[model samples]
Target: MQEKLNQFNLLKKKSEKQVAIGLVIIVVATLLFLTMSSVGSEELGQMLGIIVGLIGGIVALVGAAGFSKVKRTFKTEVLSAFFSEVIPGTDYIPDRGLAPVEVYATEFLKRADRFHSEDLLKGKLDDVDFLSSDVRLEERHVQHTKNGTRVYYVPYFVGRVFRFTFNKEFEGYLQVLEAGSPLTNRDFQKVELESIDFNKKFKTYATTELSAFYVLTPDIMEAIFELEKRNPGRIGLSFAGENLYIAINNNKNTFEIKMFRTIDNAMMEGFKNDLMVIKDFIHTLKLNTKIFKRK
Candidate 1:
């Protein structure tokens, strides 16, 4: 992992230097264009300025592309190393994810016309079956302007989705959506929790009121609060059938390396602590022994 990080840092520096070269070229060309008229070479300067500026633009675009290439490679390489060394038996797919059929089956997230997912990881640890991937759902929106109609993808959700299957089975459907989130089903009736802060942060909906109350106990709510604090996104929890679905909406490509951001202890901690969230849920929610009963 450290070796991969070292390689990434080196590539990061190279990409930055390439981008800087492009920017410097553009700046120098602009300055030369401005001074050409003062140097009594306006016509020649105009031609040279145009040529040099175009070259700079191409260089800058190529350099920018290099940054993107570096990010993509870093995610695949460094994250692969993490999965192999840190979490054996776990499968990691950098360019693939859950099918649209599987995502829609959750019935807990908004369905969009455009859906993309990647960074698929699945494994069993301590009898807990888990699968997760980064998902982004976006609907197509058109903007009409003088430049004609421009198509834009408005994102509905961009974060990681987790699915866990335990021995226990839950009755009916209970959805705990973050407040202000737009995902909901007609079958679910909204219910309010006793904690004002919890209610303020999360909006609960369920087909079975008793089951909702039973599943979302005070301590569980507290645990969810703690989980929210640890994560950098909105939390969505659903208890349906025998699986627990968690959708975190932090709007981040979690695996991608930012070339501009320094790799520090805090950042390295996050990188090294990949997939610890699954363990946290197992311990905090007690999924290992989550059995249901009639109230």
Candidate 2:
């Protein structure tokens, strides 16, 4: 990690120098063009302006490319190393396509028309196999304009999605999402539980009321409430078959490396805390408790 940080520092310095040089060239060219416009021919001023623009564009592009390369290297080396430390045997793939993301969205999210996933982490933790990645779900919208119809994607959800194998298989689907107007499928009927506080905090939906009650026991409800209290953002959960999907909607780019910033203990500590939250999910929700079994 320290070695990667040193490399990042060197790359940042090089990038900054290139950007400063580019800015200096642009400033000098602008001044020269102004001076020429006052005393020299308009053609000379135009030529100088064109030359300066080209030079500035090239320099800026080079600087941006250098910074991008450094950022990718830092993420792959430093950030991934940090995650590996937090969760041993974790494999970080910078880009592993969007098939897993699509599966997560279709099976759990059930929202958004476009999806993109990256920075995948696949491994096992405490006998539980899991796949996690930074997922961005966007909804495509079309606007009728004077010129023509324009279609673009608007991001509705951006966060990390975790899919892991549960301890046992169940018969029906269960969803525990934030309390509000329904966002899940209509097939899942809303379930009213005995706890008023739990009802206020979250809304339970499942294919059968008995299934909801069976999974969300008193202890599990308390754990769910505690998890929600720890994380104030939107939490979406789905259980189907032997797999559990959790989508944390925090609008954060997890495990991202900043090129301009120096890697420090505080930053690394923050990464540890974030990863620990995911790690704790396994224990916090008591997912390993095999109460339900397939008949």
Candidate 3:
């Protein structure tokens, strides 16, 4: 792990140097072009400007490609090392293939017309089954132009979703979305829970009010609130059958390699802490408390 970290740092430093050189070249070219333009040689200045711009552009492209390569290498190595040495028994799959169609049937994800999942981390922790993945869902919007209709794919949701098996089966579906979320269903009416604070932060919708109250005990509500406080992202939750799905609206890729920054122990620790938040969900939510038993 140390060797891999050292290699990543070396590559990062080298990439930074290249980017610095590229920027210097572009700045110098711009200055020269302006100087030539001010000298009143119009044709000559234009020609020189074009030449210098092309050269600078090429150099910048090369630097960007080099940095991109180095970043990819560093991310691959460091993530592998982290999973192996730091969080053993967990496996990371780069491409999680297609997300299940059933996910779109959920209340919060109903807007998703196109879906893709990646960076999947699936494993069992202390007898609890869980799967975490970065999910990107898109919706198609058609615009009628003069020539033809243009189809544009806009992001419906780009975030991390954690799905874990619940200890007991649920008779009906229950969804708790962040306040003012767009997704809604007429079948699932809004449920007002006993906790005013929880109701303020979240809009609960369920097939039945009885099921909603049964599932969202006071302790569970407090745990959810605490989780939201710690992670300030918009959270969407759905409980159905024997599983609970949590979707956190965070667009930033987690555990990614920084191009100009060194991967130090502090950074690694931060990554571990983030992972721990996901890993500790079972304990934090008290999922195995047996509050809801199978019918």
Q: Of the candidates shown, which would achieve the greatest lDDT relative to the real structure?
A: 1
lDDT of 3 at 252: 56
Q: List all candidate RMSDs to the true structure.
A: 3.3, 3.1, 3.1
Ranked by lDDT, top first: 1, 2, 3
Q: Candidate 2 lDDT, tens digit per residue, 28-52?
A: 8888788889986777987997799
* lDDT at position 72, candidate 1: 74
- Cα lDDT for residue 30, model 3? 78
Q: TM-score of each candidate?
A: 0.85, 0.85, 0.86
Per-residue lDDT tens digits of candidate 1, residues 1-295? 5666677777777777777787888888888888997899998878888888888888878877988888778767666766656667777787889777767656778678899999888887666788888999999999999989999999878988888874455578888888887758657888888899999999899887787887888988998889888887788888887778888888887666675775545676685565777778877877766355222
Q: Candidate 3: misplaced stretches above 4 Å?
A: 95-106, 112-116, 138-156, 288-295
Judging by lDDT, tell me the better candidate of 1 and 3: 1
| lDDT-superior candidate, 2 or 3 | 2
Per-residue C-alpha lDDT of model 3 across residues 116-232, encoded as one tens digit per residue: 777777777666677787778888999998999999899867777888887766588999888877766547878999999999999999999998998898988988888888776
